[model samples]
Target: MLTQEPIYPKPFLKWAGGKTKLIQQYISLFPQKIINYYEPFLGGGAVFFYLYNHYFLSSAFLSDINPELINTYLCIKHDVEAVISLLQQHQANHNQEYYYYMRSYNTENSVERAARLIYLNKTCFNGLYRENSKGEFNVPMGKYKNPQICNPEVLRAVAKALQVAQIEVKPFETVLNYAKSSEDFVYFDPPYHPLSETSNFTAYSRDSFNKDDQIRLKNVCVELAQRGVKLIQSNSDCPFIRELYKDFKIYEIQAARAINSNASKRGKISEVLITI
Candidate 1:
């Protein structure tokens, strides 16, 4: 008898602070028996997808503050064929002008909007998802010689992985309502605390995740910890983050920084994985 190869779904979006590189180091830290998996800040969903592909998670609740991102996931989960069809159109018409035109395009259709977001993400400079004060995606066109805009196989795999998961557009604190104590594992991968004053890139939505937001996240983590929810959080290795997660087991790991415009700043940096 012949066995089929495993098809693991990678992140559909190239997200900033994605945990693809850190998964190896984190494998031992993931809960051994996760009844319910929760990833509140579901950027890239690298870890969530990995866990779903490998583990026997009964359920999952994935969420993010970005409505468009969540909508993209929802589109993939519920209407992947339509989303892929729209992306095929995007792939055929892809050009500098079309990129800019689609960037500013608004649509009431969920599948079309999701396809547009995925197209821009693949073709945008550095694959950085940014929005201006007016809540418009302002990133310019990237210089990829051939960016894959409509990947049917990956989209299908992602749709399969997301079928058992509930994707939502909500704040991080909202997970407390759905997650049960002792049985649920919550993974927090929020925007990292900037290493320096000029390195902040937390404009995931139009709203910025400022220092106050970090404090609030720490408070939420504390409450969840008290409630017996298994928790693991990843953030930049900065004094503020260390101070905030001082009570937890902070494991410092080095990860390559690839998103910085300045090549000098795009090197190995210290990041912390806090487990509780």
Candidate 2:
């Protein structure tokens, strides 16, 4: 008998600040071999899918602070078709009435909730997952003529990829504390502290990931590096970021925004890729 490796698909939605472009450049920074992988901030999962596709890693720990985002991952893992069916139904009537209803509704199962979330993401303004004070999906209707609503194929593929990973929804510190000291790689993509006040948009929720969060994240990375865990973190190339990883190697890269609404603000921007 012969064994076969897994093949995963690309992320389905258009994610703001997704690291698809430079993820490959930082691959070499990861541990050469590891017992497991840990990603605390798994937005769009660009790095997760990248590793799952190219490497032989079979066990991993995937987590996110946003419950809705984690729910989407779990839904694709356990109930791909059901979520797809619900999303297809959402596609049928994407007017103001149905959109508001779906946004306000709640469910016992994460899969159903995740279906609604994905539907909203596909149809919302610029694919942004902004919410209101009461935690409702509040982004307005998008301008897509005929977007791909239910991608069952990519869903199934991600589901399979997730089978080899343990998914958790928790804080970055908690996730890192649970990981072993060695033979594990942790990739940090925390909500970046904005370069300027005009550009502050951290979407784990409406609550901002302020300078304090960035500082704490740096402390965690320094500890992880000292413990023999390979670390590669990405954030905006700003003074705070440079000072945080002063002893580490930093690389500058240009990233084009794919989901930003303003076309003028969608051009290349400088970013930092830190490895320790």
Candidate 3:
């Protein structure tokens, strides 16, 4: 009999500002050991997946303010087979016409909604999640010659990884409620404070993360640090963010993102990694 090799999971969504590429730079920064891990702004969840794959974690708290996203996670965690079944349908029927139909679709079924979001994510322009003034997904269909709309292997692995996590929909500040000791580690990958005028793109959800929210996040970090909670945050390396976490140990991380509206501004940018 052969023993099966463990399958490590990567992020299932193609979220904007995802830290998948930056994980290498963060590896040395992540705590060697942690009992509890919390990620408040769980976008693509590259960091959470990374930590789970690399370290020994007893518990994890993953959350985001996006209701649809949270629901998708719950559906996948609870019933990945249902999601895969629906995704297989989407994968088989994927076409330009069907893509728009799925985009304009409204579904109350959690499994169907999760499948729709995943389909759109793979086929949407740049895998960008942008909502309109009326709070509807407004991104156009992407020009993918062959998009992998469904991958049961990846989804199953993701579901297995999430079995140990308590996923939720909550504000970033709510992290302070549970994380209170050095054993608790919080990795914040908030909607960054824009570095330039053209880069102030926060349309990931209906409620934009404005400057006030940035300040509030800083305060939470300060408080978490005070309680001896291990922390690592990723944000734009701008003066404002710099001044905000002035006392924390800041390291310059080289990052490149194509999320800016201006194509010219999407290359080798500097981001800050604050640790405590």
- Candidate 2 local lDDT, residue 7: 40
Ranking by lDDT: 3, 1, 2
How do the predictions measure up, each by TM-score? 0.96, 0.91, 0.96
Model 1 TM-score on a 0 to 1 scale: 0.96
lDDT of 2 by residue, 14-117 (tens): 56677788776676676667777899988889888888887767988889788888888887887788888888788787777777788778888777888888
Query: Candidate 2 local accuracy as lDDT?
Result: 0.80
What is the TM-score of candidate 2?
A: 0.91
Give candidate 1 misplaced runs (Cα > 4 Å). 1-4
lDDT of 1 at 31: 80
Off by over 4 Å in 3: 1-6
lDDT of each: 0.90, 0.80, 0.91
